[model samples]
Target: MESLEQKSSIARFLDNVFKLSENNTTVKTEILAGVTTFMTMAYILVVNANILGEAGMDKPAVFVATALSAFVGSLVMGLVANYPIACAPGMGLNAFFTYTVVIQMNHTWQFALCAVFIEGIIFILLTLTNVREAIIDCIPPLLKHAVTAGIGLFIAFIGMINTGLVKVGGAAVTLGSMRDPLVLLTVVGLIIAAILMSKNVKGAFLLAMIITSALGMVSGLITIPKGIISAVPSIEPVFMKAFSVSTSEIFSFDMVVVVFTFLFVNLFDTVGCLVGVASKGNLLNADGTLPRAKQALLADAIGTTAGAVLGVSTVSSYVESSAGISQGGRTGLTATTTGILFLASLFFAPIFTAIPAQATGPILILVGVLMASSVLQLNFSDPTDAIPAFLTFVMMPLSYSIANGIMFGMISYTILKLVTGQKEKVNKALIIISILFVCKFIFL
Candidate 1:
C-alpha cells in the first residue's frame, strides 16, 4: 500500500511538470511515445560512431559521445522547450565532417569539431536575435504544409532504403529481392503496423516494433545480443578536443566553407523537422506559428555546440521524433523519456544497438502516412502556391536532403511570387532566405 502511494505521487509530479492534462496526453502515452521515438532512432548510436571513426576518431569514444550528446540535446528540448523533439549528430552532416573536412580538406577531426563549435555558436546568436524564429514564421502556409508532408515522404524513403526494401538502380531505385530475410521481415512488419493502426490500437507503433523484433528473432532474421549491459565507454579522447585547434586553422578558407555548409544545412534541416513535426502533432498555433519557437531553436543550437565539445558532428533535430508525436506525444515528457533512454543506452548498448532497422522501418513508414495527411490542407487551386508546395515536398525525397527541399521551395516561391505580382504576399524574411540560398548554390 505504501509503495503504491509513492508510485501515485511520482506519477502526479510528472503529470504536473509536463502539463500532461493541458496537452491532452497521459503519462503512459508520453512514455510509450518516447520509447517509440528512441527505438526508431537508436541506430544513430552506432552509425555516428562508425562514420566519425572513419576520420581516425576512436569508435568506442564516439559511441559514448553520441549517446551523451543525444541525452543532453533531447533533455533540454523537453525540459526547456517543452517539445517532443529529439536531437543527435545528424546523418548528412556527419558524412560531410568525415569526407569533406577530414579527408578532402586534409584537416584533422579536431579541426572539423572546431568548425562545428563555431557554427553552433552562430546558431545561438541567430536564435537570440529572433532570426531563426522569424524564418520559421515567415514560411508560407502552403510551403509549411508541404514541408510537413515532404518530411513524411522523406522518412518513408529512408525506411525503405534502410531495410533494403528498395535500392538504387540504373534508373533511380529498384525493389529488393524477395528472398532477403530483412526485406521479408519489413513486409511483415508493415502489414502488422497497418493492421494495428487501422484498429486504432494504443501504442500501435511501439507494439508493432516489439512484435516485429520478436518475429525477426524467431525467423533468424535478427541476432539477439548476447548480453544487455556493459560498462560505459570512455569519451576522454574526444572531450574538449575542439579547443585544441588554433585560431589560424579555424580561420582558413576551407574551414570557412565547412562552417557555412554546416550552418546552412543545419539551419533548414532543423527548421524542417520543427515545422514538420509540430504540424503533425498540431502543436502549431491557429496562425500556423509555433509557440516558444525561440526556445526550440535554442535547444538545437545548444545541442550542436555541446555535441562539438563532446566530439561529434552538428547535432540537430531528428524527424524520427514524429514516431512519438504520432503515438500521441504532445508534450516534453516524450522527449524527456527519450533522453533518459539515451542515457540508459550507455550501459545497455548491446541491447539497444541490436534493434534491427527492419523493425523500426515499418513505424517510420506508418508515420509517413500519418504526416502525409497535411497535404490535404494545401491550397492546390493556386498555381504559385501549388507549384512551390509540390517542389518543396518532392525535392525532399528525391534529393535526400531536407535543406535542399526547403531551398528549392523557397527559391521557386520567391521568383513566382515576384513575377506573378504577388510580391506583397512574400515576406522580407522569405525573400532574404531565397537570395541567400541562391548565393549558396553559386558561391558555396
Candidate 2:
C-alpha cells in the first residue's frame, strides 16, 4: 500500500509539473526516450574529449567536463523549460576550437575558453534583450544554409586529414597510401557506418566506433591504454586559466573574430534544434515557436557558460534529441533522465578517454554527411545566392577555417548582391558584418 501511494504521488507531481498525460506520455516512456537519445549521442564524450585533447588539454578532464556540461544543460532544460531536449558540447564548434583556434591560430586552449565564456555571456544578454531573434532575422537564409553546409564539409575534411585518408603535398592534398592498415580500417568502418545509418540503426556512430576500435585493436593498430578505470581527472587544467591568461588577447581583433564564430554557430544550432525537437514533440505553439522559448534559450546559454567554467567547448542543443521525441518523450522527465545518465557517465571517463582517434574520425566524417544534407533545403535557382553558397561550401574545407569561410562568404555575398541589383536585400546588419569580415582580413 505504501509503495502504491508513493508511485501515485510521483505520478501526480510529474503530471502537474510537466503535463505528462496531456502530452500522451508516461514516466516509463520518458525514460525510454531519454535512454534512446543518450545512446545516439554517447559518442560526444569520446569525440569531444579526443578533439580537445589535441589542443593539449587533459583528455579525462575533458571527458568529465563534457558529461557534466551535458548534464547541467539537459537538467536545466527539463526543469526550467519543461522541454525534452538534450544538450552537449557541439561537434563542428569543438573542431573549430581545437583545430582552427588552437592549431591554426596558435592560441592556447585558455584563450579559446575565454572566447567561449564571453560568447556565452553575450548569448545570455541577447536572449534577455530579445536581441537574438532580431539578429537571427537579419541574416539572409542563403548565407545561413551556406554556413551549415560549409561547416559540414569542414568537419569531414578535418576527419579525413586526421585519419591520413588525405595527405598534404607541396602542390595539394593528395590521396593517402591505400595499403596503410589504419586507413583501410577507417574505410571499412565508414562503409559499415554508412550501411548501419541507411538501415536506421540507433547509435550508429557509437556502435561503428566501437567495432572499428575493436578491429584496430585486433590488427595491432590501436594500443591499449594504461588502465581502464582510474580516478576522475581534475578540471584544474582548464578551469580558471582562461580568464587570467586571456586578458590581453581577449580584447584583440583576432579574439573577437573567434568569439563571434562561436556565438554565431551556437546561436543558430541551438535555435534550430530547439525548434526542431520541440516541433517533433508537439511542444511548440500554433505559430511555430517553442512554448518556453526564452527559458529554453536561457538553459542553453547557461550550459555554454557552465561548460566554459568547467573547461570545455561551447555546449548546444543536440538535434539527436529528435530521436527521443519520436520515442514518445514529451515532457521534462525525459531531459531529467538524460541528465542523470550523463552524470553517471562521469565515472567512466577512463574508458571513454581511451577510444582511438581513428575510430572517432569516422564519426566526424559521418556527421559531416548528416550536416551537408542541409544544403538540399536551399534554393539554387538564384545565382546571386548560389555563388555565395558555393563559395561557402568550397572555402570551408579548402581554407580550413570556419571563420574564414563565413568571412569570405559574407564579403562575396554583399558584393554580389550590390552589383547584381539586389541591393534591397543587403541590410545594415549584413553591411556591418561584412565590414568586420573585411577588417578581419586587413587588420586581424
Candidate 3:
C-alpha cells in the first residue's frame, strides 16, 4: 500500500499527463479529442511531402516545412482563440497550388507562394476591418449548415480515394471491389470505429487505426520496408523562403483575380470550419459568437502568411480538428497537445508513413460523419428554410465545392423569398453576399 504523500504525488502526475486542470473532465476530453484529431490528419505530413517532392521541392524541405507550419500554426491558433483548433496548409489549396498555379498558370512555385502571401495579408486586413465577420453573418443559417455537411462529405470522399476504394474514371467515377486487400482493411477499420463509437469507447478513432494497421501488417496487406522507418529521424530544417515579387508584377489584372479568388474561397472555408468546430465544442457564447473570434481569424491569417513563407499554400483551420472536439475537447490544452504531436511527427514521419491509408481512412470517414451532424441543427419545418438548406446540402457534394454550393443556395433562397413577396425578411448583408457571388462567378 502506498503512503498518502506517494498517492498524492501519483495523482499529480496523472493529472499532468491528462492535462487535468481544475476542470479535469474538460481537459481529459480535450486530450482524447486531440489525439483522435491527430490520428485523422497524420496522413497530411506524408501526403504533403509527396506532393511537394513531385513539385520539385526537396523531400526534407517539404517534411520540415509541413511539420513546422502545422505545429506553429496550431499553437498560435490555440493561444489566440483559446479553442481546440488546429491549422495547416489546407489539402485543397495545396492541390490548387500544384495543379492550377504551377502547372496550368505556368508559374514558378515561388510565384505561387507570392500569391498565397498576398492573399493572406489581404485576409488579415479584411478580418481586422470586420469584413470577414460581416460576410459570415450574411450567410443564412441553413446555407451554413449545408456548407458544413458538404465539407463532411468532401472529406469522406477524399478518404475513400486515399484508401483506393474510389478511383477517377474516363467517363465517371466508380467504386473499387472489396476484394482488394486495402479496401477490405478499410472496411474493417470502419467497422471497428463504428462499433467502438457506438459503445461510447474512448480513443475510438486511434484504436481503430492502430488495430487495422497491425492487422494489415500481419496479414501481408501492408509491406514494411527496412531502413525507411528509421529515415524519419533525418528530416532536416526548412528555412523560411520569402516570396519576392514586384508590386506591379503581383498587381497585374490576372494576378489580382487570382488573389481575390483565393481570398474569397479561403475566407469562406475558414468561416465554415470555425462555425462547425465551435458548434461541436459548444464554444460559442449566448450571442452566437465564439470567444476571441477575431483572434482566431488573426491566427488563421498569420498561418496562411507563414505557409507562404514556408513555400506552401494557404493555411486554415482544419475541420478534422472537430474530431477532437466531438470527443469532448473544449480548451486550448487540446490544441497544445495537438501542436506537440505535430512537432513530434518530425522525428516519426517514417512511422506515420508506414501507416497504410486503409488504417487512417476510417478516421476521416468517422470525422465526416461526426461533422455532418450539424444538419440536425437546421429547422426543416418551414419551406422557406428547408429549400435553401436542401439546396446547399445537395449542392456541396454534387458540385464538389463549398463555394459553389453556397452561391447557388443563396441565389435560390433570395429569389424564392423575393418572388414570394417576402423581401422584408432578407438582410442587406445577404444581398451583398449574393451579388458578390454572382459577380465572382460571372466576371472574376
Best by lDDT: 1
- Number of backbone collisions per candidate, in order? 0, 0, 2
Against the unseen true structure, what C-alpha lDDT does each candidate score? 0.94, 0.78, 0.75
TM-score of each: 0.98, 0.70, 0.89
> What are the clashing pairs of model 3?
30-329, 33-324
Model 2 backbone overlap count = 0
For every candidate structure, what is the RMSD over all alpha carbons to the true structure, in angstroms? Answer: 1.0, 5.5, 3.5
Q: Which of the numbered candidates is closest to the native, going by highest TM-score?
A: 1
Error of 3 at 301 (Å): 0.6
Report the CA-based lDDT of candidate 1 relative to the real structure: 0.94
Model 2, stretches more than 4 Å misplaced? Answer: 1-63, 77-116, 201-206, 223-228, 236-297, 312-342, 401-403
Least accurate stretch of 10 residues (summed lDDT) in model 3? Answer: 229-238
For model 1, the superposed segments whose C-alpha errors exceed 4 Å read: none
lDDT string, candidate 2, 1-444, tens digits: 999999999989988887888888888888877875675567788889899999999987888899999999999999998899898998789998999999999999999999999999998998898766554445576766666677667667877887888999759989878999888987988888788778877556656777888888888898766666567668677776658764578789888889988986677567546643464455656544446677889889999999999899999987667556655778888888898888877775555545665776666677667667768856789888888888876787897655566667778889999998889989988888788668756754
Better of 1 and 2 by lDDT: 1
Between which residue pairs do clashes occur in model 1?
none
Candidate 1 lowest-lDDT run of ten: 247-256
